[model samples]
Target: MTTTDVHVFFLLLCLFSPKVAAHGRIPTTLDGPFSPRTRRFDPSLRLGSDDVPMDDPKLAKKVGFNFPEQIALAISFSHTSMWVSWVTGDAQIGKNVMPLDPSTVGSEVWYGEESGKYSFVQNGTAMVYNQLYPFEGLLNYTSGIIHHVRLDGLKPGTRYYYKCGDSSLKAMSKEHTFETFPTSPDHFLRKIAVVGDLGLTLNSTSTIDHLSKNDPSLILMVGDLSYANQYLTTGGKGVPCYGCAFPDAPIRETYQPRWDGWGRFMEPLTSKIPMMVIEGNHEIEPQARGINFSSYLTRFAVPSLESHSESNFYYSFNAGGIHFIMLGAYIDYNQTGAQYAWLKKDLLKVDRELPPGLWQLGILLGDGGNIEQIDIEHADDPGKCPSKNPSIPEFGGICHLNFSSGPAKGKFCWDQQPEWSAFRESSFGHGILEVINSTYALWTWHRNQDAYKESSKGDQIYIVRQPEICLANIAKVSSKDQ
Candidate 1:
């Protein structure tokens, strides 16, 4: 037999071996163009998927006035710097609500490699935002002071302790610690957790609990964060879809307090590990005079200027040897647009030898429990295909087209699962990504239900890279540029 044929035979034997199965061997991408798989949704789980109430200790304010609360960390452009953020004072909601003076509270972070021995002090800006609705029966909301301070020129892969607050007022926060990502390509970040559409729900807690157990170094939150817009000015149970519930409302109503609650909910995990975020439709909380995304913009600190993108909606950052490009779906993405131009420039700077290029593979990480309900409907499923313009997006267009090729040729909906889908499940979960080396990375999905079975992983695989072919293509692109 030919060499390629012999290699294939050995791979098939190893994959089907009972011993390998018992040993929990993870399949790699080279395994095949896998057949589509659909795990049946569990009916036993409650379908209501209600939002966790604000009264929960996890969502309540933990600090006194002018003291830092809802603290979080974010990666700067590189490992030499890290961004620290938190909120101070109480947010107000109602008519005639007065905005907090950010000047009242100082934004500072005192940090050093050793515990309680701060050698460096960094001061940053503080700001507050308001969400207003001019229509009748709607209330205006003002936010607490949001602070973001960047700690710079630090040793990579080292632990540091810090506190944030107005030190002069003796309102300093309790000490917190975080480790920086390594700068070398030879070493990898411990683990990177990825989740999307995570709302404030019981299922969300399960997902977060499962993720926290894994102890990830970084988090990539692909947005749909708080679901704040799912409620009215007078807070109530979050709706599955804002448009469906408030079709005739004058403007999209938002209980801005939900954002604060979400900040508090995420502090436990985000305070140490940096969470990089991109905007999702749920973040567009529209209010008076076309104002939108006020809370989202003011609350988070991202490396926009460091990457030269200059927009919080999209940016790029590095952790260890890996470079991450976060694109904004809600922003201008045309070829002639500024975002597109920035993307082209960013792509050219990738270190092809160390970080390498990505292949065309789609991994859905959007099942992180949201009150909007788990997205189980497939465009290819019979009678389950979403209608064109089924719901209006806060931004952008939705186009539905019939498949030009594949088993369901010329069809708007497939009778069976599409061939492109490797595995599909309607369960809430989060994913962990671990780069074993420059060329190999492990991607594992952990289902919330699997918490009962600690050893159980819903799906696991090693995403392999074809360095010979892909790197050659990169060389050609480099030659063209030269």
Candidate 2:
């Protein structure tokens, strides 16, 4: 048979597979009230890995002072624009430290399709952040001048070359290149990587290397961008257990420099592809006077305002035909709270029918506290509830609360899987959503333990959109209307 015919045959086979079901943990349509399944974690994968040391070459500052370091990219509200960010200057760590004057170094980006030929220029703003510990023996920390510039009026599915820093100061980044996402919703983005709780560890390097080979157009870091708080001081030896070893400490010790190290390590990939991040518990580095989430709030820029959400903790963005909503589990999520109100409005605004064949994917991370917790309403079997609460308080405030209504109402843990939860697993894995058409999309989750070539998928499903049903709901009049 010809290549086209073979492709058609394979497509038909996938569509007809009996093992494939519609919606829930597996990809499915709104037609879900499906039974839930939980796969036990393999004993071999339970051991925690060590973080990459500060002195590692990959984590070192490759560029000189005043030159761009930790270069990265993030998606704007649309594919036509993208945000590029980086740091320039030396961070200070001592009892008495001064922050770099952001104005001292100008922030600029020069780019075009050709090398050494600057066709476009964009200027942006810069600032520095500090982690202060007033108590003696605990070192205070300050970051380098961080810059963020947005590139606009660009065509999608096209590659662009660029460099950043103060050109007049002889501080310019090495030439780097990145490709934009496809403009057409019908076109498929080959691979999109998703990962969470990815500390700077040897295993993290392995994960990054494997994900790099996949050539994902975008990356969704569900949370825990950098486990800097796991350490007591900048560049100090990170203890295996923080709460166990440092019980009497005023606050959990954090190695702020690790954030820079992580940035340097991820620059190679992030410089080219857009990465969207959500706040994880590890990001909530607390300080004096009841302060919290300082590191997370200052380091990354998310589309909270652009997406119409007021807080960075939660936001939504579109990739091809998929609409992804990243929720904040650490913030107030009660039905009467601001986040809940915002979410309701956001959900009401979605015209899923507009993006023909598009599917909706909601990813939840950091379920320790009262704001967001695992839904246990519909487990396939009893006595399988997670015994250990992995909710580490140092990461952030407790937000997980008991359900007021539903089958699992008034209970801290659900007896079975919740109706709203299609598939629930407590493993660290990333998912990829491939939009095949306006009506059908393929969803797959890859567990970290699975070999790169083996394709040992944790879950796979085809998401089907029913515009007819959605439109009917939109047309219905509520009791308030009467």
Candidate 3:
């Protein structure tokens, strides 16, 4: 065949390939800046699950006073150190409630490499917080003394057994074990699980069960944990969405017991695996005197100080070769704000050969099978595009603005699918990130319905980094030099 004819045939074959558009084929960022696409919520699958009852055995406070009930672990500054936190004493909820003295309980943890044999005992700090609604008829809630003890000088990749509580009061927990991340050249931070908007629902339980079965070394709860704000101050059934009932109330009411229940429900997993968290909108349970984020700030732990971000709202942590920047959407994300400054410094420190998302060159994983069900709104849908100023930021100033340059220039919602968003699906799913090497990482999305179906994945992609290209670009001179 002639040279021209041969070239024409080759181009045609490439364009008509069947496998290229198939769902089974995994994609890479190298093939994009892709056109935006949105997948509508499935009609067959459930939109959401009912909140788990307080009477459920898993969420009940099983431990007695002075004993640790909601035991949890968090990664500190480095692999050599880890934080263990738990609660002691029974909480009180009534018209005239008194908070327990934190000093009443001696915070301590006994741990070692061997099971049932503790070689080290560490002392920690203890404190308590209260959620009070000044208005009448709204019962006040006080939390049990929360203890946080740090275990330094730990061996990397070694499994250590621990029990935390007030030993002086003869209250100590049963033995539990966890392994530290690998310290050296192996770069083995195995499956990192990511979940968002996880409320205390049967579907949330299913998500947790499936995630546990996957055996992830770490978990990142992006936000909206427990859904405690969905309840009334009286501990009665609340409206599904936030602030739907009693819109003009003085302050948003929350049943603080839901936090306790959530802590208990998560203890089984958090006790073994370090679950790092960032605050979400639901965590902003506004009370009198402008006190918000009380439960979220008090209950869980993050590598804020350790990572040098210092603020719990936004921070960075390294797991093997991957560096994660957990940004707080509820807080100040403005360019002039503290979070933005910290983020800029962090980006400068990151190997530029890395991916985007600040210019937001990152994946948006919102498919965590949540109780509120799957998201259905799409910017490109006929009437689904959201309006400007739809909602105010929970903690910081509302900074969402119109596009300066794009098809939707001067508009908040795009008229059509924007090119940046490669694809989106409204479903309940959790993502597992498997870092294979310094340059390649595989991300898989597991749907709620696909549990127990091995090799079944809703979305799979390989994130490839171009270090050489980034290095060359960094070394290149600016246009001013020309």
Predicted structure with the largest TM-score when compared to the true one: 1
Better of 2 and 3 by TM-score: 3
Q: Pick by lDDT: which candidate is best?
A: 1
Candidate order by TM-score, decreasing, is 1, 3, 2
Query: Would you list the C-alpha lDDT of every candidate in the order shown?
Result: 0.78, 0.68, 0.73
What's every prediction's RMSD, in angstroms? 7.2, 8.2, 9.1
lDDT of 3: 0.73
Off by over 4 Å in 2: 1-36, 45-47, 234-241, 318-324, 335-358, 364-428, 454-456, 467-482
lDDT tens digits by residue: candidate 1, 58-140: 89887899899999999898779999999999999998899999999899999998898999999999999999987788899
- Candidate 2: deviation at residue 332, Å? 3.2
In candidate 1, which residue pairs clash? none
lDDT of 3 by residue, 246-350 (tens): 666566678999989989999999999998887877788888788898988888767788767857888876654456677876666666688877765676656
Name the weakest run of 10 consecutive residues (lDDT summed) in model 2: 1-10
If scored against the real structure, what TM-score would every candidate get?
Answer: 0.90, 0.80, 0.86
